[model samples]
Target: MKYLSLIIMILMSPSCSISKKNASVVKEKLIVTFSKGKCLGNCPVYDLYIYNNGRVVYNGIDNVKKKGVYETLIALDTVKRIEYLMKHFSPEEIGNTNGRDIPFTILKINDKKVVYRSTRSSGNLLKINNLIENIKDKL
Candidate 1:
């Protein structure tokens, strides 16, 4: 009976799945991915990703000042602000809102997402996009 109890206690203890050496290799969860499509004129076309580790990855496709893939890092707090913005002011937009001359973008988080073609977004959603823009400038 004592042996059984000891074994149970050992198994229930916090299992150290991430060791110290391997800790650095474990990346935070992917929080968001934004993809922008081109328009009739010079509009930036790219894809951006944000991870909880404050890592940002940007892939500029065409018609943008920056071209090619670039990776940059930001503060964890900024990433958290992004999380808050996403939760508090998620856009209800479901379809393309602007004409063909304007660009469209898809912003995804977890299982939910919103797509819009409007030149701008509403509320804190615009802040989220602004944050992404700042991330890209760092790259």
Candidate 2:
């Protein structure tokens, strides 16, 4: 029994040390921001910020369900999924078109940034819109 206990402790020590080492590696903060412009008709204009800690802030400017600043906490899993999506996003995946009246989406992933403006609606914009709605629903 003594030998068995010693062997178990020895096996557990390495994993504990490994986990501590991994925990020491600081992860970069993830932030997602979305903003929209006014259109020809009544369009909601808002600026939203989502942090890795699951804190979200939405500033509604005009024609929105809620006006002024509102803050809420989202699920950590949702934040992780958003981080994954932003990290994998590519500028080449979305094309730009001339549309002055349409809303523009500015997505920033860490230090990288992309502005999306489409005359004819695209899948990327739809994805972003859906993300915005999801975040709002949580709030």
Candidate 3:
């Protein structure tokens, strides 16, 4: 019975082996970051919105007053995938959750892999289309 349980665990482990041919067909999550622009009277922490194929999936804004508030907005096809990631990955601290531009970190990917933008990608914001194009072949 111990051996049987071990076998089940091994088989249930996450897999990240999507063939190049099928990578495009798989539903992958999209994580995008927006800049928390400079302040005038009160710094506006830009809102975070996750849109999949032009449809909104999750929308949350940060309400912090500090400048340079980084926020991550994640868009996945299913809530189960998001929950799985939230359980596995540790997220960054969000200065504000009610205003706009709440930064986020990748918690986990269901397939054990994800395609996201690098933090040092030129400007503060990373293009979603560019990220998708960069990881489409890898899935």
- lDDT top scorer: 1
Over 4 Å off, model 2 = 1-30, 118-128
Q: Please write out the lDDT profile of model 1 over residues 1-139, one tens digit for every residue.
A: 9999999999887657746546766656788999988888888899999888888888999987888888888899998898888888844533338575877778888776878764557677777777877787778
Query: TM-score for each prediction?
Result: 0.75, 0.67, 0.22
Using TM-score as the measure, the top candidate is 1
User: Cα lDDT of all candidates, in order?
Assistant: 0.79, 0.72, 0.35
lDDT of 1: 0.79
**Alpha-carbon error at 108 in model 2, in Å?**
1.7
Q: Which scores greater on lDDT, model 2 or model 3?
A: 2
Evaluate model 3: give its lDDT.
0.35
Q: How high a TM-score does candidate 2 get?
A: 0.67
Comparing 1 and 2 by lDDT, which wins? 1
Give residue 63's error in model 3 in angstroms.
4.7
